[model samples]
Each structure stands twice: as structure tokens, then as C-alpha cells.
Target chain A: MIRSEQIEPCAAAEHSGAWARRHVLDIEDFSVPEIELVMQTTSAMKEILSRPLKKVPALRGKTVVTLFYEASTRTRGSFEMAAKHLSADVVNMTAQASSVTKGESLINTLNTIEAIGADIIIMRHPLSGAHYCAAPHVKANLVNAGDGWHAHPTQALLDLYTILNRKGRIAGLKVVIVGDVKHSRVAHSNIWCLTKMGANVVVCGPPTLLPEGLKTAQLLFPGIGVETNIEKAVKDADVVMELRLQKERMQSGLLPGLRDFIAGYQLDSKRLALTKPDSIVMHPGPVNEDVELAADVLHGGRSVVNDQVTNGVAVRMAILYLLAGSREQ
Target chain B: MPSKVVITSDEMRRSIARMAHEIVERNKSTENLLLVGMRTRGVPLAKRLAANIATFEKIPVTVGALDFTLYRDDLNQRQPSVKGTDIPGTIDGKAVVLVDDVLFTGRSARAAMDALIDLGRPEVIQLAVLVDRGHRELPIRADYVGKNIPSSKDEDVQVKLAETDGMDEVRVASQE
Candidate 1:
């Protein structure tokens, strides 16, 4: 549950005049207070998740269409569960079964879903900014589940919620993001959100996997640190977030082999000892199990990996409830 | 615009004390009695009642806060400012006294009741309000009310409890 005392009342009659932003394109679109609002909403939604019935009719009759151009297991399941828990009708669309294979354009597909009376579109595409380009093409609200490597906002928000729920605050905490920093959309989104919430973020990876636009990250959220040394990056960190190593990056010669990557950066109990005793481990999972992380450490007491998965549903519920649940529509 | 003070601090305290005693008398005992307050103003009022019940019967009454922002019918018309909904323990077979500040169209009460039901199937759910203002759109009614004030549609009944507003008074003022 939320610390109601910590959140300013939902001054709906005052500052939320019109509350008309219908799409969640990226974390960059939200201010710190807005992010807090989402967190507070998620906390309330979590109570519903823990209920005996575990369902709320808040989104009754609302249609949430989840369109994923890329294959996913966790993100897709979480969104579907979140929508169903809120009593919204869910229609899942995938790239393989859809007419995209028959040459239907992205905008055409989105319009087709909108034409079928979908109220909201949650899309994850293989191309960066795919959701951005599709937003103006449909009347239904658009949620960027993930856009190539540009942003996987809900994942990041849920990660933040998980951290805040465990630690009680975000400001002044050191959060080290480890693994495929160059290709992991989860890492990109986390850096933007954690930094916005006043957490010091250090992105650590093998030099080949580190982004050439590292300067852009520092520019995006000033004071962001880039580190190649795993030990230095995690030292004194309040949180260590491990990203799943995309094995495809190996074929491209980003690293010599899985052994090299694991030896250099894979987080195990021994490596975890380098951080503060209370430091928590997190993963945006479908873990590379024992590759990017030691299987034992990922499931250890200090790991909030399972909590992240549970909070994923609550956080996505908040996103759908806020973006789709409105009387005016 | 001049506002009328319907209930003063002393009278409000006496009304709450009377309500507490009535609750004890009606329930026959404080055993398995839970007081659930709606968020914002209802929380403090519920706590006050629990405190008064403890003093009167020398027994502790469990108090919890419920936030109905997510359960409201008007979610589409406005942004919901969510609050904490914390029920200390299960109310499966207990008598729940749902507390709120004012009863107007009865929508908030209905929403809170809906939320409470989802949490657990309480043995019996009863609502208590400080002010029972006129013009309830729903057929809902409060089980215990401090005062019943006939009000016009445009008039807002404002209940100020010392815990939230730093004063104990009920005021009737025009919405304008």
C-alpha cells in the first residue's frame, strides 16, 4: 500500500486540469512528480493484486490491445495479466499470425486494431520509435511496451517501484546497471527513470557492449557514470540491476565468448560481496541463468527479481488505469 | 459569503462519544469489531472513533484506511488521486464500520463499500458519517450519523476534524 502521507493528494480538481496526455511514449515525457504519481497509483493497485478475489472492475468494458512485433514472454504476460485483473478486454496480436507477414504496414495494422474498437494499444516493435510513429495514426491511446532499444518504459517504472518499495526512497541511492548496456532497452529505460528520480546510475558492461553515445546518456541525465570495471561499478551501490545477455550480441563479436563475459562481469555471491551488505540485486529477466548472473545469486534473499515480476503487473495496471480509464472517453 | 457553523468542537466530540457508545451497545461487545475509514478525512474520524471506543470499553478496536480512487464510477471524468488502503487483518467474519466525513450523493460510500467487499466478505458492513447531507443519488444510507443537515444541491457540507484540518467543526457553504 502507498504511504498516503508521502504523496500529495490527487488534486484532480486543481492541477490535473483535463489530464489529457493519452499516451505513455517514454519516461522522458514525465516529470519527477508525475513519476511519483504513477508510483503512488501502482501502490494502490498492488493492494488489489493482493486481494482475495484479486480483480478490480475499474477498467470494465475497456479494450486494451497488446500488439507485439517482437517475441516476448514476461512483458507480454504481465501486461495481459494487468489488463485482465482490471477487468479490461484484452486482444493479443503477434507479428507472426498477423497480416504484417502479408505486407500490411505498421500504421495500417494499428488502424485496423483501432477500427476493431480497441481503446488502447500496447505495442513493442523491433524498430526504434515504432510506437512514436504509430501514435498519431490511431485514435486509441498508445503505450510503448518496448520500441526496439529506445525504451521499455513500463519495465523501468516497475523496476523503480520495486526499488522504492524495498528501500523506501530513490534519491541519493547508487544503482549499478550491469550487462548488455548497448542493446538492452531495459537498461536504457532504467537509466532515464532512475536518474530522473535522483538515483545515481552507473552503466557497466564490456567495452565492446558499451554504447558509443555514452556522452548522450550523461547529457540525458547529467552525473550518469559509465564504467567497464564491474567491481568499481557495484562498489557501495544500493542496487545492482543485471540485464540479460542477448546471445545474439555474441555472434556480432561484441565479446569473445560467454565465458569471457561471465568471467569479467557475471554477478555471483563473491562479486556481490563487493557491494554494501544490504545492497539488493535486480534483473530484468528471462535471465541468461548463470551467464550474466550466478543462478544462486539471482534467487538469493537480497534479490528482488521475483518482486520485480509481481510489481510488473501492478505497475502495468497503474499505467493502463491511468492512460485508459477515463470517463470522458 | 457567510458560512454557518452547524456543529462546534465540543458538540462534535460529544457526538463521536455518543456514536462510539452506540456502536458498543449495538455490537454488544467490541470482539471482532473493525473500523475501516475512507481515505483523506474518513481516516481520522475512524481513528477517533476507535480511540474513543478504546477509552469507553477499555478494549482496542482495529482501524484501517481505505482509498477508493480506483473503484469510483467517475474515473473517466477526472484523474484519480490514489491513497493507501490498509486493512490490518482480514474482516471475513467481523462487523466493519466504514467511516467517512460527509454523505452527499452517496457515491463515495458506494465506492468504498464496493472496495471493502472486494477485500473480504465482512460479516456485516455498516457506514458511519459525520454529516448526512441531503441529495443522495443512490439508495444508500448511513448506519450512524452525527447530524442530518438538509442541504441544497449547490451547497457544500464541509466537515473539519482536528486531525486533518486542525479544527473540529462542520460548516455549510455555497459551492461558488
Candidate 2:
């Protein structure tokens, strides 16, 4: 996390066309409208769902394969649901049952799926940007569901979608992302979105994960700041995004224990009390309630978990359609 | 700045009926046929297609209406605000035919497909449209199309079903 405003926004489409492209591997790749477009598209799509029958025909004849090298109930299901609504066939491959145990490389599996005639592949891997390495030979579109700590673009899209959805405007809001920023794809993506939407971004985590450089990524999205204290972070925040703490971090000695992590960084009732009364609280989770956030705060009025899950379909629908439909390859 | 309607009532019914016949003919049988209608006007059109297909092939059509409001990519632009999806049924390993009243820019269609995956996997999915007013923002096309009307960027194409609008029609309303 080096602080520098020296970098330039990637050239036109590289910056803008992310609104319509191949894979969503990171947050920095998208622009405001691109993110907003997905939200708007989902809104119209939701309108269609309000009726008696819920189905759409834009993806007829399309086949979307969701390959999760990791385990995810929310995102995988969200993408699956989005595909089904549009009348597209879906194939899911998660690690709970996969050929990886049988000794196949990520690239090999992706290429094999492409050969089998999948029109789109939505992948979630533990390695960062593993989707990029698989991009070359994947004859169909490649959608990165989650790749290591790199990103879960669709997750961020949904988070942004949920925020914009509840509030109508993302600009000028104060957003604070608490917890493990070092390893959270959710935090990384939300930082980009909240800041890009003109909200002030503050990343609060213990020093090691917080790092010195994140304060700089803030400038890219702009209006962002850094904080070491949990109290300071959520104080003026219009949105508080809390992330899960991987127990692995404790074993790796990132910290002593879940209790230690909670004492230092968790959004317990005391910390939650600091946020604006109407500010929204969001988590991309199977939450470790006591570990990263207190139970009461999570179940409180500010929590938008259900909305985030529901909006996940709309956001992924936007990502899948945008990436899968932009096929000239 | 808002969208307005085009096309007439009788024309909408004819287009839907025509699309129903085309879908039935291409699939060779209506046995595994499931009609998934895009939301708003598409839902009524799908019901109409089910009725028309039942008339044509002399069999019942499984009709399911789909709403893409939550799944659409253009939520903020909508005046009334969009809501989350609540689709019914299990689409796993079935031949599904998605029906929409109109096809323009293809963004709405793309979102609908993403929304589909949550329910279950489908064996075969095909798109049937009453109108194809082209200016595709993304690479998408309809399989069974009733009309291929040329449209300008500023023009809005609307399809009204008899149930909602009390008549069936397709119209092209241009921005003044």
C-alpha cells in the first residue's frame, strides 16, 4: 500500500470498456457508469421479476459454467440463479467435489471446459487473478467470480449495487471498510467502488493488513483516507463494510486469536454505535459473527446482508451478460 | 427523456402468435417446451405464446414469466426503481424457451440470462422475440423472431399485451 497519485487511469476502454468486457478480476478495472450500468440493468430486470412469472430470454442458447476452485454458497448460487432466469444452462464445479484432487491444473480444466463448448466460464479461485492466466485459451468468455485476494468483481458490483440501490446515490457518502483489508477481495473491490462513486473511503485494519500503501489507492478513487482505530473509521461513515477474518491468518501469526482480532478490529456493538444512525452495514459473508462483527450489530437495522445476497443475482447478471456478450474471440 | 410506446394491439397478437408457431416448429415438439417470459410486457406475451402454441400444436405449454428488474444492468435509469427477483420453479435439465416482447440493444436480454442460473441448469435454452429492433450494445440475437424492424437510436419500440394494456400492439415512438 504505497501512497502515490502518479498513476494514470487506464486508457479509454481499458478504463471505460470494463463496463463491457471479458473478465472481472479487480475493482480498478471499472468506471462509474460501468458499475452503475450493471445496477441499472438489474433494476429493470427486477421490475420484470415483480410480475407473476419470472424468466427472461436474452441468454437463450447460452451455456454458463461456474467453476469455483473455492467454496461459495452466495456468489455461485447468485450467478446460477441469474443464468436460470435468462433461460441459460449452467454447470457448477466447486472444490467440495472436483478433478483438482485428481491432479488437473487450473488452465487444463478451463481449456477442457472451453472445448466442451461452454459459452461462458464464471470462476472463483483462491489464487489472485488465476482467471487472467486462464483467459488465453478459454474460447468463451471468462468471468472471475473470486480469485485469491485479487478480487471478486461481481461481489463488489453487488455491494455497490446494494448501496446505490438503498440510497440512490453513492457520491458524497462516507464509507468505511473494516477488517482484513490485506486479504479481502471484498474490501479491495469496495474501496474502488465507494471511492469511485465519490464517497470518502477509510480502510481500518491492524497495521500489517492495513499497510502503508492503501492510503494511496484511495487517491485513485479519490476522497479516501486511512485509519488505524476502529472507532475513527466508522464514526462518520455512511456505509460500513466489514469483512471476515480467515482463521488461517491467526495460524499464520497475523494475529493471536479470534478474540484478539475482535478486540482490535471487530465491529461489536460499541464500534457499531459510532456509525451514522441510518448508515448501512454490509458484509459479503458467511459471517464469523463473534470473530469479525458482533451478533447484535449484524442483526441490527443497519445490516444489508439479505439485500446484498438478493442483489448479488442482479449484479452477477450484469457481469455475466457484459462479459459473456462481448465475445468476438 | 422517458420511453414511450410504439406498435398497435392487433399487431402485437399476430407477432406473438407468429413467434409461438416458429418456436413450436423449430423444436419439433412442445413436450419438453417451457415458456420463460421476460418481465413486464414479456410475461403477458409468454402467456399468449403458451395459448397460441397450445392452439397450434394441440398441447399445453408450460408458461413461466421471468422478471429481470433486479438482474438488469440499467437500474438507476428507471424512474420507478427496480426490485429483487423472485422466480419460481426448477429449470434443471429442461428445454426452456425465453420469450420477450421486443429486442433492442440486448442489455436486458443479457441480464435475464444471468438471472436464470440461480434456479437450476437447463438442457436447452432458446430465445423467441416478437420484434428485433437492432442496435445491439452487446453480441446477442433472437432465435424465433416475429418482426425485424429497423430502428434508430432515439426511437423507442414498445409491445403491449392484451391483459395489461387491454390490447395487443407493437409501436415505434420516436423522440421529438
Residues A276-308, model 1: lDDT tens digits: 899999999888889978988987899999999
Which candidate achieves the best TM-score against the true structure? Answer: 1
Q: What are the models' TM-scores?
A: 0.95, 0.64
- Candidate 2 overall Cα lDDT vs. reference? 0.73
**Candidate 1 chain A — worst ten consecutive residues by lDDT sum?**
A1-10
Q: Write candidate 2's Cα lDDT for A1-329 as tens digits.
A: 10111112223322224454565667787766566556656664544444335566556677999898787888888889988877789988776677788899888888788887788888888888687787876678887888888777778878877887777777788888888898888888777767776777788888877755664675565567788888878896788888888888888887777777788888877877788878888889989887777898889888898888987876676566555556453
Write down the lDDT of every candidate, Cα atoms only. 0.86, 0.73
Task: Output the lDDT of residue A76, model 2.
Answer: 85
The alpha-carbon deviation from the true structure for residue A45 of candidate 2, after best TM-score superposition, in angstroms, is: 2.4
TM-score of chain A of 1: 0.94
What CAPRI grade goes to candidate 1?
Answer: acceptable
- Scored by lDDT, model 1 comes in at 0.86
Worst 10 residues of 1 chain B by lDDT: B75-84
